[model samples]
Every structure is written in structure tokens, then in C-alpha cells.
Target chain A: MSLEASFADEPAFVPYLAAGDPDYESSLAYVEALARGGADAIELGLPFSEPIAEGSTIQEAIVRALEAGMTVDRYFEFVADLDVDVPLVCMTYYNLIYQYGDEQGPRPFVRKAAEVGLSGFVVPDLPAEEAGPLRDACDEFGLDLVFIVAPTTEGERLERMREQVSGYVYVQARLGTTGARDEVSDYTERSLARIEDWDVPKAVGFGIKSGDHAERIVSAGADGIIVGSALVDIVAEGHENDDATEEVAQRLEDKARELKQGALRGAGDRPRVE
Target chain B: MSTSKFGDYGGQYVPEALMPAIEELTDAYERYVLNNEDGFIDEFRQRMRDFGGRPTPLQYAEQLSARYDTDVYLKREDLLHGGAHKLNNALGQVLLAKYMGKERIIAETGAGQHGTATAMAAAHLDMPCVIYMGETDIARQRPNVFRIRINGAEVNPVTTGRGTLKEAISETMRDWATTVENTHYVIGSVVGPAPFPSMVRDFQALISEEAREQIQEQAGTLPDAVLACAGGGSNTMGTFHHFVDDSAVDLYAVEAGGSSLSVDEEAGVAPNSASLSTGEEGVLHGARTKVLQDTDGQIMESHSVSAGLDYAGVGPELAHLVDSGRVDPVNVDDDVALEAFHRLSQDEGVIPALETAHAFGYLEEHHDELGDTVVVNVSGRGDKDLETVIEETMERDLSIAPDMSIFREVGGGAL
Candidate 1:
């Protein structure tokens, strides 16, 4: 009876990669590798002319993706042909959505996105007020409009956000862009506590570096974790060598397994170093 | 046939997404301009009279002319709505869009003048309008930003590229590509693809159309030379059109050179946007004339404090004229432009846009050359540039006399 329960038991979230930095065959293989891993969900990022929030690592990934001639329609094509076993979320900017969306703007993009077998969408710039049109369209199309709540979000905004959003809440651990960081702020601690009280599933991101960070976030209250810059860095490192596709996939799998193992171990027993 | 073939330089170059719309524009422009239809001209001319507040006056700059020993006639385009000659073309495009049945309008602007004007027109017609401006421009020109928004248009801040005019154009192009089906891309200047360069030139050529008759009645002959600045070459070409075939009237196009000309920065290079000076005859952004590019054939971006002239290329028609020895192009440094800005403000009681100061700079350079007569296009007023002038003057005064002790004691100094 619970359509969402089926996905609840699904494996940990897996982030997909575009192969050859942009090479078609290699990228196709990379998507398959992500599916082969215990990834319950896959996030496929489409290259855009501008990526405002993406850090250097993901920016480079996009450059390679673009160099491989990736486009809005081509991303849809890859999704259609892949036959991968997981819910797919397209992570991208609002510019591409604005360009490709319908007369009302982002809503049109969300509607068409639903038609293309997409399970959800994650847009950085579409704030909650602006997200309404997209949310309404997604509801009509039966697609999830995933929203992001940063550590700095207050009670009023958080309550307002919970009423309209679905799928899951992305809890940003730090104030800046998505990348590895040396320290976590007290604001992040308060936010994690606040997110733990929410009814919906929570996913922590931003400065989430290794398996330990993911494990700590999950044990704190996160149902899952999203890793981008760290995974992108590994992919970039592998790109310097001769067969980067499989190697990068192996590296991602190793990290994913580590996070999964850590999730089971829990962060409660670990001494509070902070 | 004239070497200035509108065909070679006025061809279209647009992304595949907006090809249909551009092609339609080309067809509509040709149909309207070339057709012997009296209805189109009647409507266009009537609008210019009633709505556009034309024919703009041609006042003799008695002080400047006497100062330089030349009979300087000033074409007063700054009085027009939106405060520049830019409205001449904006009115033309808005009417054209109405005829074409397009429901929405999209445009790009720097310094927010053109965007402000376009927003005015769209507001008048009750058409939905979207304006893409560089984030930096939006901040610098915040007053104009609020003006356009109040006029019922949305301003989309473009954060890409160097966050200036060129980036704004790129954003506009991208938006046009997507909304081409229902939107009319109202290019702010005489840049972009074919028909646009020529189209905007033709609309703005009204400056010369009236000036020619006025000059003949007053001076008993055509002026010896006509000078104007060449930012996107709109005003320069608009004034130069009537005299292109006169053979006796010399034409000079001055470009911006900010600060010291010899300063290593790309400030005031004579050929900044002067096609003949910096460009090889190649296609760029649609128009086939001269474009500024590197040795590897990539477009070399241009820089100027004046957003209007900050482009890498000039209109191809202007390029042909400069190349064929018909028009002379010169560079004007920012110091000269600032001086001219002050002179025009103090002496004439009119503030000209920094873009138009390039022409004023040219007049300063050739003060001795003009023995008898000259006419300069006072393209736009400097209301938009008060901040620039004040800031630049303050900087100069500070550098000249930085000692706080001297300034404190200088309360006894003369005003």
C-alpha cells in the first residue's frame, strides 16, 4: 500500500558519473557500475553552460561531461536507454531548467522531467517561494521535488518548508559550496538536531568527506548521505591514468561500502572529539 | 557599387535554436523597409512624430564652436524618452514586434540605459518583457534597475563571464534561443546578427535625415566633417549615413581609451570597437563585417568603462567605410573623456553619457584642425554617468593632493 516503503528498503544512495569525462561508451559503463553497487538511488548530473554553486571538482566533471557533448536531451536519452535499477534524480542548475522548462518556467522543466521517467529533481537556486510552481507541477506529474535546508535555516522557514516538500530533505552541514572541509561549525550541530526532529527522511551533505563523516551524519539522525566533491575528486584522480572508468567506479564502490559499513556501526559509541 | 556592401557584413549568425526567429526578423525587416508600401512608412513616421518626440533639435554649440574656431552644431538626441538616441531603434523594434504578433520581448543592456528604454516600450505596449543584465551592471546601475522593474519588466541578473556587457549579451542570446517561439529579442544596440546592425542603423539614421536638411538651410552647404563615437557604432553610423555619399563631408569615428593611452591596460586603444582598426573582415555573432579576434581566430573581448562601446567588434558597414578610406577612426583616452565630461557639464549645462564623451574627446584632439566648421553628435545626456564623473574626479584630486595636513590647513585656500 505504501509506494514510498518500497524505496525505504532500497540500498544506499549512489551517485552516477559521466564516463570519459565525456566519452560516451565509458560514461555508459560508469552508470551501469553505479547500478551494480548497492545504490538504491542514482543522481545523474547534466552539464550546463554555468554551474554557480559547484566546486572545482564537480565543475571539472561537468567540463568533461560537456566536452563529451552532453546536453539536456542527451541526458534524457541516457536515462531512457540505461534500464538501471534505481530511482533517478537529475541534479542540475536553474538556468538549464529555465531554458528547457515550459511557459511558466521551472514548472515546465519539472513536468517534462516527470514524463522522462525521472523520480525527482534537485535544483540549488529554486528557493521555497520560487519552488512552489515546480512543486505543483511535480505533484501533478507524480514526481518528487526534493528541497535543501541548510544548517543556518531557522524554525519558521523550516516549518514552512516541511509542509510543501516530499521525497527527502537535503541538510547541508556547512555554509559554503559542496566540498571537503577540515572543520564543522556549531551551527551544523544545531541544524542536525533540528533535522532529526523532522518527520521526513533527511540526507546530509556539504563537507561530507569520508565514510566517517557519512557515518556520523547517519547516526546523528540522517537517513542517508550525499557525496559529490569527494566522489568527483576520485573520478578526477582516476582520469589521469589509462583506464579511469572502471577504476573510478571501483573507487566509488569502495567509498560507498565504507559509508554503508559505517552506517551500521553508528556514531553514538565514538568519543565526541569536538 | 559601394565597397560598403550591407550584404557581406549584414548576414545573420545565430544559434540553431533562434534561427527561425532571426530568419523571420530578416524577412520582416526587408518587407517593411524595401517595400514601396506607404502604409508602413506612414505609421513609422507618425509614431516618430507623436510618440518618439522627433525631429530632435540641432542646436549650434556656440561656445564650443567659438572656442575651437569651428561651427559646431549639436544634435540633441538626449531629450528623447529614455534619454538617448537608443529609443529611435527601440520604437522601431517594438512596432515591428507588434506587427509580427510576438507576445513577449527579451533584451540585454549595460549601464541599464538600453534595458531601461526597452522596458519603457514593453510597458507602453503592455507586453511581457525580460531583461538580462550583468550582475555588476545591475549593482552599478541600481537606480535604472528599479526604474525598469517599476515599468513592469523583470531583470535577470547574469552572473557569468567577466560580469559585464559581453556576458549580458551572451545571456540574452541564450534566453532568445529558448523563447524564440513566442519572444522577440530586442537587441539594445546595432550589434548582433544581420538586419539588426543594419536595422538599428536604419532606424537611428533619422538623426542625419533631419540634420541634412537643417544643415543645408542654415549653413548654405554641408558641414566639412561629421564626428561621433563608435560604441557598437550606432550613433556614429546614424549620423554618418546621410553624408556617406556626399564626398565632401569627412566622417570621423572616435572610440574610448580609458585613462592614459600608453597605460598597459586595454583601456583606450583607438581600434577598440572600430572594425577597420582591430578586426579582419570575418563573421562574428551574425554580422559578416570586421570582428576583433585573436591570431587563433577566437574572439578577443573588448573593455571600456562605457558599457555601450564595450564590444569586441563594430558593425560591418562601419568597418567597410573605415577600410575603404571613406571614414577615419580615432581613439579617445578616459582622461580626455573625463575632461570633456566636465567641460560639457559646466559650460553647456548638459551631462553626456560616458559613451558620447568619446566624440567630445575627438573634438578636443582636433581643436586646431577644425578651422571653420564641425558637427558633433551629442548622443545622450550624462545623468546616468554622474557617479562615474564624481568618482573619477575625486580620485584624481586625491592623488594630486593626498596630504591630509595640507587639506586641513587649506581651509584658507581659495575655492
Candidate 2:
């Protein structure tokens, strides 16, 4: 089933994971745990050398993964072992995709992704203006190319993105890079309101840390709630403690469940404009 | 003209949060800089003359020319107000930012020349400025750092990836993504996403424009070739711009050959910062340029005796120029550059920044191959490099004479 179809009944809870964090086997276990913990979709991070949009948490996670010998092909091998029912999307920088394919361009990457049962892509650095090549490649491979809309986006750009985007639109929770914030900014509310009329499935991300943060975003009319740094922080803590693989997986699954429950509380409470 | 491509080289590859700001900059640049509708062009030229000390001399280097057996003329950018050609773009961008109603300015510098120039311009424009520099660069380029702080701008030290120019650029871009509403990013080179490479080249093009006229008036003919060192390719682009269409004139861009381009069998460290000669096509720091990267496309750390030339990538425009055969790319090792640095100082009484010394080093080696008349862009003064030069000279005196075969191994043979 399409990921968008799964969002129709509830505010979908999507948890993000940096691939090969700690190790390949543990990361795969975390994906399954997220699915079992009520994640409607999974956003798997393909580690790049430089992840400018990410704050220190995700940045460290990427560094750890890269040091562990994570590559595009290895990432696919890990994903092939997943048995989850939730849709899985890869979030990465554009350079990886640009260099992934054979001489035929990004088609090889997209083709491999589709063959591996991957749902779509969320490239933060590939803004709508520079997404033509990737978008075309995704189209050829029957995969979705998701684009993001930030608090600073407006006017023709918003409309243009609304028309071009597929799968779902990523609504950034604030004006900054990804990190857990104590409180969600009012800017996210305004951005959500501004784009609510676009008639697209929107997932609010980039600062949604807790169930309360997820509740606030779903209440503000987000079709889905995306959490990244918060989950990665748990995995990082587990690594620091040198916990057993199952123990870390258990902790991540429990947090995913808690955030999913929070998203459910605001499932039908879409904001009504005056 | 609105497109951000130099023959499939440059583009805005930043996050969505920065797209609006990039678009606004593109719009402002088109309206004010390219169109020059509101007398901004005239004001810019007037400021160049009155503030930046423009119409700098086209000096004929008699002693150096005699030594090299060629008619060598120097476009004396070292004599500019800020001691380097950096002020040309700094002053222009700061003015454009003011015209756009931006109250704060941000910049990234490698060797502190661009930071000092930006700080000076910000002080003149009465805007709060912040300059990001790598910790390694800050330690090496201390004098320029002091000059920046004295100019009333905050210097933010970056300690991330490799702690150098590339990391500083990443930090500045991250800062701009959040503070785009009231800030302008005055990039220090002919690199970055869009509008920037084009915009910076347009501002620095004065070097070529003035040199083209001055060389004709002084030497009675256009030079056979123009040479400038390529760090981010700003100085080279400025020096090569006016003569691009002059089919008879050749353009040479020299990059740093750090320790050596060839790997040391015992140490295993290869030469650094020779992106054009030894790098592959990839995207980095916003533009698709030739970058020194590993097989996995990860950006590798670059090395150079000169902080300004220690970058893993070249400007996308220069990458295109290299691919198109319009510009000949050359590499000069640290020892050769040091030799040229001392020779130019002793012969012409003009000390050049280590970065600029690379161009002179190439000319000194290939003088016989160059035509009768040649012009070299003296991009900066060597004041900031005095400490580094002194330290290197002392070290060389203490150690054995270095092997000179690395020069012939990695010189202009590729060209």
C-alpha cells in the first residue's frame, strides 16, 4: 500500500533512524522494533560525510555509521533483511544519490531502492529548484520524491513545491537544523496553517521530540508526525552504556510507542481556521 | 543570465530553508548588480576609486622580467586598500546587502584576508558583522584575525570537519539558513551555490577590466597570457575575465601542491589542494566542482603551506574552464613557491602572499614557454604570511635540503 493511504485513518507516526548506527545488525533490529512500536512509516538516514541540515545528534549518528563502513550498497543489503510492514523511506543528502547510479545517472540508485522495497526518498539538500534530475529518475523507477517546505517558504515557491512534490510534504518544525527542542516554536503552527490548504499529506519534523510535541503538530493540522534526533539520542545512549543489542532495541521501541500514542491523541483534532 | 550554471557546473544545492534567501539574493543581484538600474553601478565604481584605491598600477617588473627573459607585468592587487584584491568583492557585496535592507552580514574566511576585508567593509557600512574561521586557520593567520577584531567584527572559530576553510564554509552556511531574514552572506570567493560565483566574479572583474586597459597603454599590446593562483578561483577569474574572448591570450591557473602530489612511500601522505589536477567531479559546499575525494565520494582533507589555498575543491566556473581548455591548470610545490616568494621579495621588493607566490612560481618555471609579454595577478601582500614564512625558513635552515624532484613530477606537465 502507498504510504499516503496509511495516513488517511490517523496521524501517521514516522520514526527516523540513521542506517548502520552502532552496527548493521542492530540498526535492522531497531527498524523492526519501530514498526512493532506503531511507526506507520520509517525514514532511514543514508549516512553521508557531511550532513549540514542535521544538528549534532544526527550528525554524530552519521559519523558513527560511516565509520562502521556503511555504503549505499551495504545500506540496501541491510534493508533487504527488514521484515517490517511500515513504509520505509531513505533520507539523505543529494550527493549520495548523484554518485550512486552507474554511468546511466541516478537510475541505478532508484532502481536498486525500488527493487529493495523502499518507498521513497527525502533529500534535504535537493531543494525543489535543483530536484529535476532526481525527480525524473524517481519517476522512471516508480518511486516517490518528497520535498520539504520550511517556515521561510512562501508565495510562488510554496505553490510550485505543492505541485511538484510526491509521496508527502515534509513541514519543518522551525527555522533551524534538526535537534530536539524543549518547546515547539509558534513558527511551526504558522507554517502548518499556511500550507494546510495545499491538500497534501504533511509530516512535521525537525524538532518534534516528545509526545507533547507530536500532539502539538498533529493538532496544528499535520497529517503525520516525524521524530528523528529524539530516537537517535536513545540509540546513542544505549551505545554509551554498552547495553545489549536487544536492550537498546527495546528502549527505542518503547519511545516510539510513546510518541505514537501522543500522535494518536491528536488524530482527529485538525485545526479549524476562523 | 538568471540561471546558476557555468556550463553544468554551478547551482544552488542548499537545503529548502535557504532557497528563499538564495532566491532573494538572486533577485537583488539581478535588479541592482546586473541591471544597475538605481545608479548602484556608478556608486560602486565611485567607491572603488575613492574607498578601495582603484586604478592600481600595472607595474612592469624589470628585474624579474630580466631574470625570467619575458616581459612580466604585475597587476598590483597587492597594493589595494585591504592589502589584497578581496576588498573589491567585500565592498561591493556589503553595499549590495545594505541596498537590500540587510542589517547584519556574515562571511567565511580561510586565511583571514577575506574576513579582514569584510570586517573593514562592514565597519564602513555600519553593519554588525560575524566572520567564521577554522581554529587551525585562526592559529596560523593570527595577525589578520587581530585586524578583523579591531575592525569591530566578531570572529567565530569553527572546530568541525578538518577545522579548515571547508568546515568554516559549512558553519557559515548553517548560520545563514536560520538567520536569512536580516543577514547577507558575503561569500569570499568565486564559489558557493549560485549567484555567488557569478556575483563575486562580476565584482572582482575590475582587475581584468583595469589591467586590460593598463597593459595596452603601458605595453602597447594585450599580454599573451594571464596568470593567477587558484584557491577558490576568485583572483584567477578576475584576472582572466576581460581576456577570455581574446583568443590569442592564454590563461593559467596555478593550484597548490602541498607536500607533493606524489605519495611519499614511507609517510603515505600525498600532495594537497590540487583539486583541478587530481580531483573528480562531485558536489560539495553547494556547487558541483572538481573535488579531492575518496572513492566513496567523501570529501578528503586538503593540505597546503598557504592556508588560503588549502581547500579540497575548486570553483565550479574554474572547473568548467579547465574542462573547456580555456584555462591551463598548473601546480607548484611548497618549496618552489617559497623560492619564488623570496625571489620576488629580493628582486622586486614586493612580498607576495604565499597564495600569490604560486602564480609567480609557475611563471618562474615556465617563463621560456610563455609568450613575449605576460601579466600575473599579484593577489595579496605577504604581511599575513610573514610568521609562516619565517617559521618555514628557520625549519628549512635546520633540516637537510629537500628533494626538488617533486616539482618536475607534478609541475605544468598536465597542461
The candidate that achieves the highest DockQ relative to the unseen native structure: 2
Cα RMSD for candidate 1? 16.3
lDDT of 1 by residue, B133-174 (tens): 989788777778998899999999976645666667766776
Question: How far in Å is the alpha carbon of A123 misplaced in model 1?
Answer: 30
Measured as a fraction from 0 to 1, the native contacts recovered by model 2 come to: 0.60
lDDT of the candidates, in the order given = 0.69, 0.87
Question: Clashing residue pairs in candidate 2, if any?
Answer: none
Per-residue lDDT of model 2, residues A109-200, tens digit only: 88889999998999888777777787888888888888889999999888878877888889888886888889887787788888877766
DockQ of 1: 0.02
Angstrom error at residue B61, model 1: 0.8
Cα lDDT tens digits for candidate 2, B1-415: 3379988788888888988898999999999999996888889999999989998899999998898889999999999998999999999999999999998999999999999999999998899999999999998898999999999999999877667898888889888888889999999999889989989999999999999999999999999989999988899899999899998999999999888775332221336789888877888888888887665566777889999998888889999999999999899988888888888888898999999999999998999888999999999999999878766654464232244345446542321
Task: Report iRMS (Å) of candidate 2.
Answer: 1.2
Fnat per model, in the order shown: 0.00, 0.60
Q: What residue runs in model 1 are displaced by over 4 Å at the alpha carbon?
A: A1-274, B1-8, B36-38, B260-276, B280-282, B397-415
Q: Give model 2's TM-score versus the native structure.
A: 0.93
